[model samples]
Target: MRSVLDRGLALYRQGEDLPAEELAKCTALAVQLAERGERIAPLLHAWDVGCSVAVAACWVSARPGEQSELVSLTQWSSVGVKEITAAISLAYVHAQKQAGLDTSRRVLADLMLNGSATDELAAAAHHSPAKEYVAVAGRVVGENVPSAATVARASAALTTGDLGLSCQAGRHLCILAPIRSHRSTEELSGHMVETLKRVGITFAAPAGAVIAPRSELAMAVQQASRIESLAGIAGLDGKTVESSQVISELAISRDGEYRRQLISLIDPIVEAPELLKTLRTLYLMDLDRSRTARRLNVARRTLTYRLERIEQLTGINPVRTRGILAFVLALAARDLDLSSSVPEGV
Candidate 1:
């Protein structure tokens, strides 16, 4: 959240409207936040603070001759202020929760996103949730995320037909759904899938775990994320992925030596977000250039340009079978290394 605030501040300081993609990310954050939290006053406050600071930035970025108009002393009219403030408020609200439980969610999100716990904060939230629950780690993405109220309605089946708490975990929405001890993993996965489908929310197949005690939430969440490597079990993308299946990918992902090597190899392309996304989609489309281009809605020439640039940057010809395998492995490593990586200072 602080990072999001900083980004808003930087954009505001530049006197630029928030980019549509960035706004969307913030909006998605808000939707997931809505899953467990109920209010967003703090987020609002943070945004307001960013806006206020951005206004002051005019004093610094403005040239001597342009100072009067940009600064406007007392400002005859509140011209751009209202629009900027509204944008900040709305976008921040989209990423915010209802009101309380901010700290609890923050701690949990940090642990899930980074894969380590903040002892003091985690301890406080630890005792609060159910003791025997299942952890579901996966993401829900798109322009129109379901409303918080709508998501709450869906949590019924997710929380073991009882209650569950879904919170933000980096790029994923990790839910700790409470379940009866007797419930089997198959029954649990079925319940989760049915609930999400009913809500009209299409999500990546989740990595799930039947958590024994509430205190081990951090570990459960980590295991859940790693389970995503179990691609064989996933009949489709938007289904639940269980831990019992991810033997190979999980094993390879755990090797720190290989992970770093892949990171180094992939970093050249991954460093460029657009290229990385293109490469990922291409890999998903089974290295079919025409299909990938169509999916990306780009012309064949443009796709070629991007792919050639990627090969140049990564020094690996993605057109080859070996190169394609490398691309796939690199992406998996990145998912494990950067996205849901071990927590900083862990």
Candidate 2:
């Protein structure tokens, strides 16, 4: 919430209009709060505080002999703040009517993913068959997981042109967004992260592949989910992992024998907990020796010794290109059993 306020203030300081995207984010947060049994008072209170802070910002930035314009500035700020507050209040009321649920969006998401969306539902949800789209799959973490409807509403607010659809399928949150540009997936995912943060919801989803046709959405979602799991195994959390970032590990994760062989490459270092930690930290830090040593809270000399020990045990240098890739893939393959991966048309 503080971050949201700060972001709003930053935009104001820069003399920029509050984009529709930011307003949509506010609506999403209002829905979440109202769903959680919060009243409109807190939302208004936050807005009031924002108005005060924004006024203070204006005062500080006022030029010499501009005292006469302060009244004009205050009036303008008051109007803008009131409008934003009213919009958020209306969103709260709307959410209350649905008991803070987006049941329709959830149903629509399920139907689309299963290829069962009726023409009516597709039309209502604004899903276009001829449009290009992308799937972002994730698992909600932390104490407060936003409902699928809330996610869909938030995604829709951030989406341009036709709105996107989202739903929670078992443990995964699947969002289908129309591709507005090459960076549509990246921008939407980033907005989701920011909006959800205001209400304390986070996703452990990575970037998903683009879907040229609506028919492949389900498969792309499933594949994204699998990549998400792969990222988890590599100790990557939040939205930090991209599909492209883990392509190599994903490629070798399927073969049972090959996976075991890769895991074995690190098995020797695994027996020594310190050495294993060092190796993992090294990779996590992108093989930066100085940073890795500082993260491990060890002297550079000690860090070097651990790297040497890992090489002695695994017969692979940890610093070189081939060696680093091998170790990273090995670590990713560990505990990644995809035998029960999502089946087609599921």
Candidate 3:
């Protein structure tokens, strides 16, 4: 298997028409080996099929008349050749700007609805070196197109820390990301983009769009804050959990006096304009001083000096393990508090 992967990769790196053909052959062979009751079959097959499809699609697109040959090549390549071949056919139609988009979309839709077994096969093929590549297929053809209300429901489900709902939301979002990107980013940001499209959200890569596990509570707080008609919105409101109150309680419960002490210690430094900017960047960059320095376009030593000054002014070491935790929580608190003050649904 290792030899098979090495051969395929080597062919890929060689970079020529012949190499592409040879790589396709090697990938097909890798897929065969993956299916021979190998434990890592899923991963190997994923890479094998992805590379083969990608290369063959490119080749066929460049030489549109060789459609039959492309079909034949894919048919002989693997057991699930029909689906792969269909993908190639669609890719060709898409490239040629032919009337096959609707046809291809319908085929894909059917495959997603009735092809769970194929998805599992693809998942198996996505097992190792191929895992990442196979996921591309799984994300594309396996995902269901959820509605906008489904997205909102999924978001709401996430509020309860229900892992299943979170997963459902994540999967739906992953699909939505790519569809949105197709109009915006490019043809190939892969499965991650697809997932986002399904969920109907666009996220810039550098924006760190991944929802942290711990952030679910924060999401719930944000959602609750959006109920304008809730009595909590009026000053004489009925009793309900204020989002800031929730955050403050959670923060205090997690750290007690240590949390408050840390906030007090850091507040004065944050009041200093220059120091606040540095700390803000540091937190945003997850305390990667080098990245913070890069974002600030300051020398690393200067960043260090700024951090040191923060610690000096506040009597708290930013680098200390406890200090870092406290700082992040404090920042979360500040964000929650500020968000709570905004009118609901804004």
Candidate 4:
């Protein structure tokens, strides 16, 4: 079994079309071995199936015009079983749509029932054919179907790859992407901490949160302790008190202070109070002055003047980092207090 897996991996590394086919064959053998009551590990079986599916997905994605043939081959081969079947059906539907097929409820139903109709399959089906599917899936899966405002917030976080913010916006349904840069983990973590604040996700980096390739579970616990110590110095409160925290109370407190300062700095420049109401709209629209002005039913020149006055009062450039930070803080603050004073318009 080990020899078969090694051979499969070697073939995959060859990176040729023939090698992909060979790998698929080996994966089938591995699956057969597992089903025959061999000592094959479930993880090994999973890997084999995943590799076969990935190779097939690559083939289809590379030659979209050949998707039908690929799908047929995958289905008949039973390479990745239900998963490959679903992929094939999804690819075919997408290809058909691109070719101007109607691709409505009928097509969706066909795809859903084509393979094992797991929850994901059903959810995908309902998304296309039925409005009620989303609500039902939301209830069953405990996924938060965020409001339009929350969607907007989540979209912004996704655009920037701000995982903590995305998770917060999506109500913990999102996972932060693993850091891939050459920067130290601590630095990357610090940046994540700051970004989470901007997006209003409260989390702590207890030792356990600082997982590394070589770090042991004990080391992780120690790291959590270090984070807790740091949090105490920062003067923050947390959802719970533990030796380890993913986010410290001090970080939350600092975020609150930063937000307050932002509002305090901006509140004096409101030559036109209505601009405050437009802040969220403007930020969502990516600070396009002309676009914001149009949305607010005001002239571009008037909008520019107000923005300039706001900059003068806040001493933060509307187009720069400080200004963007202030804008976000102000928006969050608005949600907390509608009757609060509008920042002075620049």
Whose TM-score is greatest here? 2
Q: After superposition, how far is residue 27 of candidate 1 from its true place, in Å?
A: 46
Arrange candidates, best TM-score first. Answer: 2, 1, 3, 4
lDDT of 3 at 121: 32
lDDT (CA) for every model shown? Answer: 0.57, 0.65, 0.40, 0.41
Point out the higher-scoring one by TM-score: 2 or 4: 2
Q: Candidate 4: minimum summed lDDT over ten consecutive residues — where?
A: 131-140
What TM value does model 1 have?
0.40
> Which 10-residue window of candidate 2 scores lowest in summed lDDT?
337-346
Per-residue lDDT of model 4, residues 212-310, tens digit only: 222132233234434443433433353223333324232323365664655565576545466565555567668887788888888888777766766
lDDT of 2 by residue, 265-284 (tens): 98887778898789888988
User: Which should have the higher lDDT, number 1 or number 3?
Assistant: 1
lDDT, candidate 4, residue 173?
A: 21
RMSD of each: 17.2, 20.2, 19.7, 21.2
Candidate 3's TM-score reads 0.30
Candidate 2: where are CA atoms >4 Å away? Answer: 1-102, 126-130, 143-161, 181-184, 195-200, 205-212, 237-242, 335-346
lDDT of 1 by residue, 1-346 (tens): 4455456545655666556676556556656655555444455446546655655665677786876665553242143333433444343333442444234443343333332323343344442444466777665646134344434444433444343556554445566666655777657756665677676755654545546456676667766755643442323343566655554456556688987887687787766887888888887788788999999999989889998998898889887888887877777776666454333321
TM-score of each: 0.40, 0.60, 0.30, 0.26
- TM-score for model 4? 0.26
Error of 4 at 137 (Å): 13
Extract clashing residue pairs from model 1: 30-94, 30-95, 38-98, 39-97, 39-98, 39-99, 40-97, 40-98
